[model samples]
Target: MRVLGIDPGLTRCGVGVVEGVPGRPGRMIGYYVVRSEPGEDIALRLLNLDRSLAELIAEHKPDAVAVERVFAQHNVRTVMGTAQASGVAVLAGARAGLPVETYTPSEVKAAVTGSGTADKAQVTSMVTRLLQLDAPPKPADAADALALAICHIWRGGTRAKIQAAALAAARRSPR
Candidate 1:
């Protein structure tokens, strides 16, 4: 499966594409940081982000999209900008008719590094090793985005199978 992972932020949204199945190392298709000027109006920033994400979705043609779920932060402004960027990312995936899943930071960290509380350095190191990259992806956000893709590739397939089986069983049961 090919997955596009997004770590959304107003000024520096991370985007990455990975392709592989469960229980194996994923290949990095591409990685990028979509940047929007912080000084720009919020509407303009969001619009630009949406356009960039749309182009990425078109170019990569991912089977699914995995986004970092927005969580509470002390700075409301920061959180709000992240949440807006995240919405644009999700919408881009949905517009492309792909399944979109959101994972918390802890979930992504645990999947990549086997520790939910793993720090950025740990996650970056693990991602570099897992993907067999020559060097770690830059700007922490980029690595985080790749980690999100790896997490979904590893877990999403199993989740889909489980859901399919449950649906089949329900269909066969007497009401």
Candidate 2:
């Protein structure tokens, strides 16, 4: 499966493409960060993100998109920007007719590093080893993006199946 992972931020959105399945190592198809100028208006920043994500979806042709789920933070501004960027990612995936999955930071860390509270260094190290890359992806955001992809490949499938089964069971049950 080809998965595109998005680490969304207003100033620097991380994007990564990975291809592989569970119980096997994945290959890094591409990884990069999309930058938006702080001086730019919020609308422009979001627009730029949307365009960049759309371009990536077209270029990579991923089967699914994995986006970092924005959580509540003390800084409302930061959280708002992240949520906006994440929305753009989901929109891009939907526009391309691909499945979109979301993972929390802790879920991503646990999937990659076996610890929900793993530090950035730990997650980066594990991601590098898993992908067998020469060096860690720079700017942390890129690494995080790759981690998100790895997480989805390793866990998202099972989660999706479980959700689908639950939904089917619910539909069959009496009200």
Candidate 1 segments whose C-alpha is farther than 4 A from its true place: 158-175
Error of 2 at 119 (Å): 0.8
lDDT of 2 by residue, 11-85 (tens): 999998999998788999999899999889999999889988999889999878899999887378688888888
On TM-score, the candidate that comes out on top is: 1
The TM-score between candidate 1 and the true structure equals 0.89
TM-scores vs. true structure, each candidate = 0.89, 0.88
| Deviation (Å) of 106 in candidate 1 | 0.5
TM-score for predicted model 2 compared with the true structure: 0.88
CA lDDT of each prediction against the hidden true structure? 0.89, 0.87
